[model samples]
Target: MPTTPRPVKTVLASVTAAVLLAAAAATPAHAQSPPLRDLADQQGLRMGAAVASHLLDDADYRRTAATEFNSVTHENDLKWESVQPQPGQYSWSGADRLVEFAEQNGQQIHGHTLVWHSQLPSWVENGSFTPAELTQVMEDHIDTTMGRYRGQIQTWDVVNEPIGDDAQFRNSVFHRVLGEDFIAQSLHMARAADPEATLFINDYNIDGINAKSDAYYELAQDLLAQGAPLDGIGLQGHLISGQLPQDIQQNIQRFADLGLEVMITELDIRMTMPVTQQKLEQQARDYTQVMDACLAVSGCSGVTVWGVTDAHSWVPDHFTGEGAALPIDDDYEAKPAYWSIHEALGGDGQNGPDDPGPGEPGTGTCEVAYDFTSQWGQGAVVEVTVHNGSGSAVQDWSLTWERPSGEQISSAWNSLIQQSGTTVTAGPVEWNRSIAPGGQVSFGFQTTHAGAPSVPGGFSLGSESCTIR
Candidate 1:
């Protein structure tokens, strides 16, 4: 079902400037918004999305992908059918364009699917060959593909969807001709081609402790015992709204126990069509749940949403009466899911586009407003906005507050934060150091507390007492 890739348009400087101007006019707040990639980086995790090569021509699509994600995956361009459609013939233009885009944007490339049962070229699927010849063909494919991008691709799905719902190996061409040995062989060949790349076996429906996951767990143990080169397990979290697996953290921890990294790959929470406000809200909570599950597990490295926006989501074509599976709308507006994910990644957690932020207009020289953006059993995200109500601009402002006993500040963003004993001081970073007379700057921090979170008071700006709201 892969579409033919269109010629990628190289964005000229003039067009790029125009696009930026148009985008700013359309959504001015986005310019000051902290990107998801920055928030995820603060936590030592990556936020990624799958990219359709054809969509790179769209300015909005390209801009969102470049700004929001730290890693990129080609949706179909790197598949066997897309890359090699004929015997001894390889097409690299579409794939190369995506790689170039990722490199230019400083994003890591997750080379998808060196081997899979689906999306195979007709020559590979319909060819008549003996087991030895077929094995040679597979090895050659891996060598050529992996060798071409050895150091550029940080990780790869060496084999994909190898196990079935019935907890047995699928009768794929590789499995049918060479039995289960083909998986180990593919891993070995991939390692030989790119020794530094992290190799993974990816699949769907293994996000929890189900029979399919059990099968993979056993298979991984056996492969490692036999000295196969395996480094990670990819759980494709293509889930329905409100149906996230309850034991997601446990499952990730179990895989981590195997001494292999775990990643939530191909994540999308789809719902029935004619999307409603309630459905969208539920989807937001579901997205936050998935982020929380990943953040809770030490071995879970990152997550990759399947596509950039609902306009480009594949759910409608595949699932009848189901759509709206992404964080951005068709018009390039941020959905509730986007804010949920932002807060989950330790952002300031402004409610939505219309949110006026923390406080009303004040007559005092400086005013501070504090709000608890998100709270769980033991953790909370707090946002403090510093309003510059003075007639003149405020330069290089610093704020001080006392931390409540038994509360611990884990991480913060948009400022330089430090604590000694019960007192905490925060100063603006270079980009946010100056605030106009009527402008305000907000900073957030994540904290762990016992019982309910205690609010810190007695705020001061430089040597002046500030009005609190």
Candidate 2:
């Protein structure tokens, strides 16, 4: 019988879907993009990181999903029990809501796991079942869960952590009865159910196909030779600063050589408890190296960190004395990790993943919309309106720009700003002016752009609200 996994919170929601448009803004005058941009933008290494609990409630998660990432995976959203609790009884509400949320946000979804010994429901592990019965239960679970997410999830961890660091399979019930065949069987079941979905055998300890990775690697190769359904190998990269096993990239490439798409799933760099400057810097270096590996390989899909913010990380809960493993801080503030990823993806984080996206730069209670209308070479007049919905004043805010060409900012209106590489800064757009609850005010800027960021969706006004036209 599978056991019920501990859930952090309710994953169900009634999400309203709406279409949105982008506001046209004149490109800032005399601005240029960074000359030394990271290779990610050109290669399209889709940006993503796991989210914290705060994101689940605020509209930020949707915005984060839309702008920064092309694909989103449940940090703990798609655990085994969340899908199947009792035999043949499946719950689609939580996972369904997540899928809807991802779709509305203009992102793709990845199924976390179809089989994991850790989070299995109680019945599946202890329930009365013979060898044949267990296999049937396994088959049923895969068919139902994968069938529901069939095409929506581009990749599914058909089996997660099937073996320990030792060469043998872990002591899950499946191992006791179905024996080592459980892995091959589970893969077959998931593949049969969702042939279109990419099936991956995911596990940690394989960052650089070491002994543990090799065991799984050999297993995967043998299965492929026998014509089993295995699409990719997911490298669970939970590395510390400066210590990504030397062969990690080579391991990933080696797996790719076996004719499978390689993904750096669950990639995060942790540090000693109170994060130090050295660790943070090393974290940045490690992150860049992983991106280098992905860029070096041809079939690398992309990297997905376990979570974006530190608030809801699985590290503190699971790994002792280790914290701050993700890119952004709990408040969704940009850390070195965030900047590293952006630069890696050709984004000089002047104006980051839409102000409305989760893990974005703004505090999304007050509505702020800006309009830029001017010639490309002229100082543009951008009008910004700050509408206060909640009883608060946006003490500080700023609008920044990055040009497409390799030019730099020679001048700016605001002095309290700093320019980074090709990114030009203009403000700590301090609204010493306050907007009373339900009141509104407007502000403007003079700038230039090679082009404007597409507000691909619409202006997310607040929770359950959008300014759709």
Candidate 3:
């Protein structure tokens, strides 16, 4: 059911789009204008896109993705047939290329899938292995592939599209062979392969409270009780024109309360082709609402659009007569949805009255937020988000924070970390160095502790100190 109002007729010219693209490219890196990635960073969440391996060679597509997003998921290259075409044989060239590119750009790589019903190689799809035999095959596949990437990838859609809208497990090969336990077994294998990576069960049509998502919630609770090593749930936010999920926040919060981080892993709103002004406006509002929902929930870690640009989007091919599903258009220009996301992220360089904490005396425009993803008897994963409220983009950022007396910074992700004595410095990698006005950057670290873990205070970005909240 549609929840928002339909848009009035609006139109845009090609010339205007060209101008927007020029302005976007010409803006100096240090200017106050920030990209969507910067905006998401300020909220302690990630903004990402799904990229095909071949698209990395497209300069225009590559530039837009590198600048606007902090994470990348292989749209298809990491899938079954693409990676392993023959039994006991593998192909790593395509997947590896994207991995190297993401590493060079300081973008986090999200392994799209380890198990999926579609695109399976003929060998695996046709092999008439017994239930016990098939379980071994699946386990071997997970172990071999996950072991190759190890800790380089941050998250894995360990099992994808598992549940149908009818609230029952889909008739996928793994499900047929191993029955209900395939989901749990796959997750455990992924965790064993990469102990640090976050394992997620990803599915589409789970954007809001419904039969499909409910089934996932129930299954997740069961898995957790069985100690199945599930850490997150991915809601593929593929929406149609004028149709927004009304209970998005509540749904995400419910899963979060289950001790799992939720992600909008593949977000894009599709509409009729030859886009109209009204449709674009509607799209903008839709994108804003989605980003706002994630921001409102402490457990929502990130949002990933299905594609970076309409020129390369899968919507057209996948949905007849429906296209224009990305923030960037085919002409390499920013669309209405781009500004909508910007507005939602507070990219206007103004610190709202609701800022979580106060800024330093001279740094009136900065804010900081802190939270723990998980904590246990001897260790904890802490998330830190730095918001830049200045009028110009920050090209180079350096933050200083003291490590708690007994806490040791064991590892960090999404940013570079350095330590000297008790003082720890964190900075953006090459890809995340620029912070737009009112934008932010988020990073997390695992700490080793002898006693109960405590949050670290006294944070600063560059010479200007931040108000730790």
Q: Which ten residues in a row have the lowest lDDT in candidate 2?
A: 21-30
* lDDT by residue (tens digit), candidate 1, 306-381: 8888877877777889989988877767788988898899876553323334346566788887777556667666
On TM-score, who's better, 2 or 3? 3
Can you give the TM-score per candidate against the true fold?
0.75, 0.69, 0.70
| Separate clash counts for every candidate | 0, 27, 10
Q: Which should have the higher lDDT, number 1 or number 2?
A: 1
How would the candidate models be sorted by TM-score, starting from the highest? 1, 3, 2
Candidate 2 lands at a TM-score of: 0.69
Across 190-246, the per-residue lDDT of candidate 3 in tens digits comes to 988889999999988889999888899999999999999999999999999689988
Task: Report the C-alpha lDDT of model 2 over 91-138, residue by residue, as the tens digit.
Answer: 676677777655544355778888888877788766677899989988
Candidate 1: where is the Cα deviation over 4 Å? Answer: 1-15, 24-31, 351-469
Give the lDDT of residue 136 in candidate 1: 88
Q: State each model's CA lDDT, in order.
A: 0.80, 0.61, 0.76
TM-score, candidate 1, is 0.75
